[model samples]
Target: MKTGNKIKLFLVDDDAVFLKALQIQFMENDDFEVETFSTGELCIQNLNKKPDIVVLDYHLDGIVKNAINGMQTLDKIKETNAGIPVIMLSSQDKIEVAVSCMHHKAFDYVVKSETAFVRLQKVISNIFKYQKMEKELNWYMDRM
Candidate 1:
């Protein structure tokens, strides 16, 4: 996925307005190529596009009653490509929810708020930094 210069980002949320706003936020920056999906199923279907990161809504079934939720989506994504990073987004500020997301292998959990985008930016930055370090370490180990 890192083969491209710009990060490919998948934004999955049932809230049209919120999804559009978030898409606009990421699109304003040239660093990302953003793709928005209204449901987890749609996002999963398009996962073959190989997005570098996925920002998934915790309540993905808001529009479709039987649609898969964020946790399920995360698990499916991991099953398909464990290397892809998934950040779970939700209005739930509960510690348990965040912990559950972490347990389910979410790269991070973010609460939807005025400052959510700012926090997301920081989290994304950290993710890339960590990936870089990991890559470098692997390179060094390979030579040893």
Candidate 2:
């Protein structure tokens, strides 16, 4: 999609306050159209809406009994549509968690903190830039 169009984003986190804050934060940006979900199941159920990107929390707790964690949710999402970019969010900064997220095809893994939203903005910008370049390359390839 082009920059002229608002990027559809799905924000999935078990924290009600955090989720709402994220939705509000993204709403300030003209480039984003945000949707908030509290659990992996809700996020998965709305996949038909086809968001351009998904911000999924690493641990989904308290929302449901045995709710899918971010990694499992990532797997399920990729199973349905591998192309959708996903940014995995967690409060922990462990190497193994980051590697696992990458293994599951997450676009990026980010640790939650005071600066998390700022970093997320940067990642989203990068994803858009990369996607634009991919589209241009595909268009060139089709011309050959």
Q: Estimate each model's TM-score.
A: 0.95, 0.93
Residue-level lDDT of model 1, residues 1-144, one tens digit each, is 244599999999999999999999999988999999999899999999999999999989889999999999999999999999999999999999999999999999999999999988998998999898999999999999
lDDT score for candidate 1 against the true structure:
0.93
Q: What TM-score should be assigned to candidate 2?
A: 0.93
Among all candidates shown, the one with the greatest lDDT: 1
Candidate 2 clash pair list: none
Enumerate clash totals for all models, in the order shown.
0, 0
Give candidate 2's total backbone clashes.
0
**Global lDDT for candidate 2?**
0.91
| Alpha carbon lDDT of each predicted model | 0.93, 0.91
- Model 1 clash count equals 0
**What RMSD value applies to candidate 1?**
1.7
lDDT of 2 by residue, 1-144 (tens): 335788999999998887888888889988889999899999999999999999999999867988988888999999999999999999989999999999989999999888889999999889889988998999999999
Candidate 1, run of 10 with poorest lDDT: 1-10
